[model samples]
Target: MQVLTAVPQVLSYVVALVDEVPEAKDVKAGWLAFAIFIGLILAVAFLGFSLVKQLRKAEAAEEAGLYDPSDKKPTPMPTVEPDRKDDTAQNGA
Candidate 1:
């Protein structure tokens, strides 16, 4: 009857609407973003590990008396000779 015919028409219209939607064609960009994110994470992890190792090495060195403690008198800074003539005379007021 008319009701059965209308049901098929409605179903076809719904199917057409579903088919009209565009499929995802740029999946590679998503993968590239994921790869970059993972690389950043690994880089940060590597830096953290390096920092810990260096800190441990420094602690060990301190324990071995390789460096003097700051509680003691500081070492004098070495004096450096000027490499160039003073520029004050060149700048006329």
Candidate 2:
């Protein structure tokens, strides 16, 4: 099949259609991008600080016996014991 035959022609046509393409040097992360980056950094820093503060508070609460910590798992429910008599009778039958 000549399925891929038009690929090269299409690529060449696309290249020809393009009048100009800026050099790599012309591309830049402008002030808007820099501002957004700075904003993200500040947001992360704020969240980190807030997280630390919350963790400290949680530690204090745990020390004061307000609530149990996640590391300490809750006591599991006791498993039900099967009737030994029924099991023995069934086996005998």
Candidate 3:
């Protein structure tokens, strides 16, 4: 487990080594930047999804508890339009 923790440090050192070589410096920086950008995007997306899921779970728990539903207003579900060529026809146009 301790060895696993040192992987990032080892990888960083390898990148640093490549960066020291004039011919490989640009490649090193580009790869490093790409990896960081992808990691950031994934982190943000995961965090946002986790937060929404937690909120939903909390709401469900509240609904199942000894609390009056009328006391707290529930969030409305958004209306989604049907994806039909003739919307009226689908709904008896």
lDDT: worst 10-residue window of model 3: 20-29
**Residue 93, candidate 2: C-alpha displacement in angstroms:** 67
Greater-TM-score candidate between 2 and 3: 2
lDDT of 3 by residue, 1-93 (tens): 999999999999999988765565455457889899999999999999999999999888887885676888779999998866877877895
**lDDT per model, in order?**
0.86, 0.88, 0.86
Query: Model 3: how far is 62 from its true place, Å?
Result: 1.2
Per-residue C-alpha lDDT of model 1 across residues 15-82, encoded as one tens digit per residue = 99888765688334578899999999999999999999999998899888888677557789999987
Report the Cα lDDT for residue 6, model 3: 100
* lDDT, candidate 2, 21-69, per-residue tens: 7799998879999999999999999999999999999888888988856
Which of the numbered candidates is closest to the native, going by highest TM-score?
2
The TM-score of predicted model 1 comes to 0.45
